[model samples]
Target: MKQLPLPMHLPARDGFDALVVGRNDHAVAHLRGLVPGAGVAAPVYLWGDAGSGKTRLLRALAEQHQAQGERIGWFDAGTALPWTLDEGWSLVVVDRCEALDAAHQQAAFALFVEAGTQGVQWAAGGRLPPVDLPVRDDLRTRLGWGHVFALQPLAEGETRAALRREADRRGILLPDEVLAHLLTHHDRDMAHLMAVLDRLDGFSLAEKRHITVPLLKKMMAENIHDLVPNPPPAP
Candidate 1:
């Protein structure tokens, strides 16, 4: 285990279970299986669409590894790569892997390949499927080598559960009617919903108002753009 100045619990910091509710179980389970089992050399690859919980799953994995006292290096492709060949051995959890160019991908693959032997595990999430991305044959082969898991979108019921859970965690009282109104009008993506919820929490606290349908209409209408689709352009 990683002996450190502080014993950080993976579940708490990562919000492991809370952030990834509904349709996250399958991918989470598959990634956990990667750490165990006598599998072929290589890190696990989680491929999914944006807001499909790929990044959340990756964080959960990295936190778990960190709790074990292992060093974990995170590479965010949204920004430039500070990664080099030497940044191995640590549990590598790279997000936005699809954003990395071909050359960088090859370099990352080479490092991960080495890590496989040194008892270093890697986990990464990518937007592009291996077949779709402009990648070297070797890198594609390596990415495909590990267990492939797809994070599916949350169902409507799952969506409701997620909303309720988020409200509870934030200690905000969101009634069912308000939730339904938000879900009906807003984008189906959880991230957007969460943002709206955050705004609601702030506005409600500011005004000392309860979160109800009437309150959501008055407050959200002021801050949020209409979720309803604009009328079709006149012919």
Candidate 2:
């Protein structure tokens, strides 16, 4: 197969206000939109199902923003900021933007608008588009004023490719047969797959063995064989 671009950046630490997305195709594009004229729609707003890689893309964007020497501040809204948001920061990122209750939602929206003029570019993620939001007017309009993009869930094909790519990243030689089995029988979630892969990766490294069908079988038996029925009689 041809080489694909790197699976996109993963944040080392998750600031509460920002999101961490997965290896979905939209990751880099979403990050690039942060630069207003970087050939992406401006004032980008991302929407996606829960666990659909929204946070990961947000994190990638945060990484790019930080790389360019821009300061990014995160606000969960649920947590009160000890100081005013008027502090010096070029980017203010908020996730679960919908979590703000009605009474204070307008104040939150005003902050977003204020942040923009204050040299802080704002990006937020929520399930509904700002136009569709029924929250406070200022907040809803503020959300709608920017570019709005929704993240689609990864297809099975994409998920499988992600698995293979991750295995390569860890220097684990996942047998083609074992890879096929895992992708076919297990959950179609990249997040879940990665979580389990870490365990498999560590095991393979400790044993000084490449990932093989037998090794997978043994690992699964010790841990998650119950996840996949029968598991093809264990090779």
Candidate 3:
């Protein structure tokens, strides 16, 4: 049977400002201070467990450079490109270094060497510190050469405060009870919580009701999925 494509998600907002720093303020600050193509001596390496915002931070840096009219080459473990260094690239970002296969690892190592020689700023993220990464010895050493930051997950209180901030930004009146219920009943990751808030806002609007615990329950009972529409299949 032919497989139906998965729904396309809207790109999540990622920037230093959009990030909830939690206990990772130093890491955020380092990335914020980086000037693309400024002859940075080494790559900034970030490591954290799943949902710890490693990917988000990398993307945020890339977006910042791109906004400044710098050409960026971004690669992840799943990137299918040949991973050759482009002379025009002002910055290069590699995410999910922990998941790289043999070929991708080789490609990443070569890209790092070329980027270093050509004065291209680079950053990388992974689930483990360079010393503990399950990659080649030389590549692991390269990963550890620069500033290494271990991202810490937000505490429960921090997550709640972040949700409240988002609600305020969206001009939504989120009640304490409803917020508590969401924290108790759903995934607590910032991304998942934010998506829940988005869906709840839409559901409340559709039902012509103010957001409340009852409204949240009704929305949950109906098992409302992401309100974002799926994109058309590729030709």
The number of clashing residue pairs in each candidate reads: 2, 7, 0
The all-Cα superposition gives candidate 3 an RMSD in Å to the true structure of 6.7
The better candidate by lDDT, 2 or 3, is 3
Q: Write the per-residue lDDT of candidate 3 for residues 2-107, one digit (tens) a residue.
A: 2332333334567678777899999998888786656565689999877687887888898888888888899999999598888988889999999999999999
Q: Give the best candidate by lDDT.
A: 3
Which residue pairs of candidate 2 clash? 20-55, 20-56, 21-55, 21-56, 21-57, 43-147, 45-147
Q: Estimate each model's TM-score.
A: 0.77, 0.67, 0.82
Q: How does candidate 3 fare on TM-score?
A: 0.82
Top TM-score model: 3
- Model 2's number of clashes is 7
Q: How many angstroms is residue 118 displaced in model 2 relative to the true structure, after the best TM-score fit?
A: 0.3
Against the reference, the lDDT scores of all candidates come to 0.68, 0.63, 0.83
Full candidate order by lDDT, most accurate first = 3, 1, 2
Steric clash pairs (candidate 3): none
